[model samples]
Target: MLMSPTNRLQRLADDSSANSLSHRLRARRFQLFEQLIGGLDRPLSIIDVGGTNRYWEQRGWAGRDDISITLVNLEAEPQVHANIQPTAGDATDLSEHADDSFDIAFSNSVIEHLFTVDNQAKMAREIQRVGRAYWVQTPNFWFPIEPHFLVPVWHWLPESTRVAILRRRGVGWAGRTPDADKALRVIQEHRLMRRSELAHLFPDAKIVGEKFGGLTKSWTALGGFPALDRVTA
Candidate 1:
C-alpha cells in the first residue's frame, strides 16, 4: 500500500533514517556546531534544552568523555548514557542553573512549541543567561510547507480553518481528533517564527538561513561563536 504524504514526511523526519533529508540537515548542523565549539581545549559542558538521549546517541555523542550533556525537559528522561544527565526543568525559566553555567545551550525546533511570543522570549533569555554560547533553530514562518503538518500553506490559513482540517484527519505527527477543543489547541501550539522575530530575540547573534530548493526552510540563531563570520558569510 502507498503511504500518505503525512506518513511519508514523518518517515523522512525520523532520526533513524540515515538517508533522510532531516537527518542529513541535522548532521550538517552538528558539524557547524562542532566548528563553533572546536576552539575550546578543555572538556565541554553543554545543556540541551528539550533534548533527548536518543538524539545524542544518533549523533554519536552519547558516551564521549570529552564532553558532558545535560538534557532538560518538562519531565526528566531516563538516563542511558554515562555522559548524559537528564534533568526536569522549564525552558521559560531556567533559574535552577547559574549564569554561564554551561559552555553551550542547544535547542532544535523547540522554540515554536512555547505557544506564545512572550514565552519564546523568556526561553531565549534563559538560554542566553545559562550558557556562554547558544544555538537555537526554528522553522521559518514563510516556508511554503509547514514542517509539522506536512501541508503546503497550512500555517498561513485562518486558525478556524486549521482547526477544522485537524478535526477531519491526522496531520503529520498529530493524530485526528474529533474534539474541537483538542484540535484548536493542537493548531495553536505550534507558532512558526519569522527572521525578524529571531533577530530581535537574539540581537547579538548571527541568523543563518537553512535553505532547501532555494528557499529558506529554517533559521538558526548562533551566538558567541568565534567562527560566526566564517560560518555566516
Candidate 2:
C-alpha cells in the first residue's frame, strides 16, 4: 500500500538516519538518566535487561569507571567492555536476583518484543522486584513511522496484511526486504503497547514522552528514580 503524502512527509521528518531527531532524543534520554542519578553517589550498580554493552559505549557517559553495569539477555556471554558484566537471563522471570538487587534496572526498546501483554506485565513486575529503580523505553504505537522498518504506518495494517507483506521481499521503508519467513517470525514477536498499556504495566513509574515533529515517538517508563520527583518538580 502507498502512504499518503502527509504520512510520507511525517515519515521523512521522523526518519532516524536522515536527520538529528534520533540523536536529540537519545541525548534527552541520557539527560533524564543523569537527572535521575543526580542524588546518587558513584559506583552505581545497574542491571540492563535486553541490552548490550554497545548501548552504553555509544552514550559515552563520563566517569564510566564509576558505574558498574551488567548486561542481561537470552544470549550467553555477550561481548562487552571489560568494565561491564554479561548475564544470561529472561526478561519475564529474574528469580536469581533478590529484591532491590541493583540500583537501577535499565531496558531500551525491549518491552515490545515480549509478544504478549501478559509477558510484558511479568517482565515489568520482575524489573520492579529486582531493582530499586528502572527505566524502560519502547516505540509508541501511535507514531506514524515504525522504528524497525522506518516505514510510515506499516504497523497500522492488519496482522494478516502485515504477514503477507512480510512474505514478499523488497517491500518496506526505503526498499528494504522485510518479507522473509525469518523476518516474519521476528516481527510477530513484537506487539507494540499504547500509552495506556504502558501506564497500566508500570503504575508506579512515570510515563514520559520522547517526541518527534511535536508527536510522541516513544514512551519511557521511569520507576524508583529518587530524584525524579525533584527533577519533575
Candidate 3:
C-alpha cells in the first residue's frame, strides 16, 4: 500500500513529536526528584535526607514490608504518615545509625545547600557511610541560577561580585550571602555537578549513568546530570 507524501510527512512529524516528548518527560522526572522523591517503584528501604518528601505517602508508592521509608530532617519528626519515620538529624553526622543502614539514600540539590564546602563533603561521606548507593542529584554549574547552586558554579566567584550580580538579579539580596546555604533555603533546587567534581566525590564508586538536566529548554551535553550505579561493599 503506497501512501501520499502528505501522509508520510504527517507520520514523520508525529513520530518526531512523540520521541521529543518522551525525552522531555524523562528529563523532567529527574528534575522533579531533585525537589521531591517520586516515580520510584517497589517496596524498599528508602531514605531521604534534608528535605520534605510526601509523595510516597500521598501516592502509596510503597510496596509493603519489602520497602520502608524514612526522612532524616533537621527537626523533630512531624506528625504525619504512619509509614514514614522522620528523624531529627544532620546529613553530615549519621552516627545514630549502624553501618550499612539503608538501601537507597536520596538527596536532591542538597549538598550545595550546605553552609560550606567542607560541610558538603561531610554530607557526601555520610551518605556513602549509610546507604548502599546514593542517587544524589544537583544542577550543572554552567547554567543560570533559577532555583539555586548558581548556574556557572558561582561559588568559585569572588564573594563580592557574586553578591552584586545576584543582588542586581534580585537574588541573594536582603543581606543574605548567595552561597549553597542560602540556596538550600531559598531556591530549594540547585545546579548539577561538573564532570570532575562528580569524579572526585565518587572516587572509586562507579558512575552508571548521567543525563543533561534542565527545566524547559535545551541543555548541552556538558550541562546534564550524573545518575549513578553502584555495587555496595
Candidate 4:
C-alpha cells in the first residue's frame, strides 16, 4: 500500500515547506481584502459565519477595537475577548439577524464542507441578506492539487481508490485522521467549486482568484467592492 503524505495542516503549524507557498498565497488573499475594505473610515461591523475569535486574532485584527466582529459557528467558542462576540448558528439559516445588519459577512474555506450545492446556495443567499457586502471563498476545483489533501489529482480519482488510499497512507490534513472511516467522512463532506459555480452564487460580486505557482488555487466573491470608491493609500 502506498503511504499517505504527511498531514498538511500539521506541517503548516510547524511551518513546513509543503505549506509555505500556500500560506504566502493565503496571506496575499487577505491583503486583497484589507485593501478592498480600506475606504471605510468608520468602525466596521462584521459577521463571520463559521469563524472564531482566534481566526480574527490570527488575521491580526482582533485588537482593532474599532471593528465589531460577531462570529457565528456551529460550535460555540469560549468568550476569550470583549471585542469579538461568539454566537452559535447555522450559516445557511441566519434568520435571527436582520437583513443588512452587518457591513460585511465574511467566510473563508467553508463552502466546500456544506456537502451540497443547495446548501452552498442557501449560505450565499443568507450572507447577502445579512450584510451590505460579503467576502466568501472556497478552493478552486480546477486546481491541479487538491487543497485539503495536498495531493495532485486526488479529488479526480475514483471513490473506492480514494478511500483505499486514505485507509492506507492518507495524505495531507485529512490523512492525519488515522481512522479510515473518519477519513472517508472527510472526503465525502467536501466538494470543491468551479469558477462558473462561484460566479453563479454571487452574480454581482467581483470574482477574485487566488493563485498558487501561477495556477488558480481558490476564488473569492467580493460583493461590495464595486460600490466603494478606490482608496488611495
**TM-scores for all candidates?**
0.97, 0.84, 0.58, 0.86
lDDT of 2 at 201: 88
Tens digits of per-residue lDDT for model 1 on 1-233? 99977778888876678988889988987888888888975699999999999889988999999999998999999999999999999999999999999989999999999889999999999999998999999999999989888888999999999888889988877899789999988888899999999999999989999988999999999998777778862
lDDT of 1 at 29: 77
Error of 2 at 123 (Å): 0.8
Q: What number of clashing residue pairs does each candidate have, in the order they appear? A: 0, 1, 13, 1
lDDT of 3 by residue, 1-233 (tens): 99854344344323125354333443454554333323344455667786454444433443346566777888956746555777889888988976667767777556666655567678778777777656665544444432332234455566556545554454322235456456344433333455456556656554323333532222211111133221211
The prediction achieving the highest TM-score against the true structure is 1
After superposition, candidate 3 runs with Cα above 4 Å error = 1-43, 55-66, 149-157, 165-169, 172-192, 206-233
What candidate 2 gets wrong by more than 4 Å, as runs, is 1-20, 77-79, 170-184, 231-233
**Model 1 TM:** 0.97
Looking at model 3, residue 233 earns an lDDT score of 16
For candidate 2, give the lDDT of residue 77.
67
Candidate 4 lDDT over 77-100, as tens digits, reads: 987877788999998999999999
Q: Residues 47-157, candidate 2, lDDT per residue (tens digit)?
A: 999977656776774237888888889985655566688889899999998999999999988999887889999999998988999999999999987776556787787
Ten-residue region with minimum lDDT total, candidate 2: 169-178
Which residue segments of model 4 deviate by more than 4 Å?
1-19, 175-183, 226-233
The collision pairs in model 4 are 4-169
In candidate 1, where is summed lDDT lowest over 10 consecutive residues? 224-233
Task: List per-prediction Cα lDDT, in the order shown.
Answer: 0.91, 0.78, 0.52, 0.80
RMSD of each: 1.1, 4.3, 11.5, 4.0
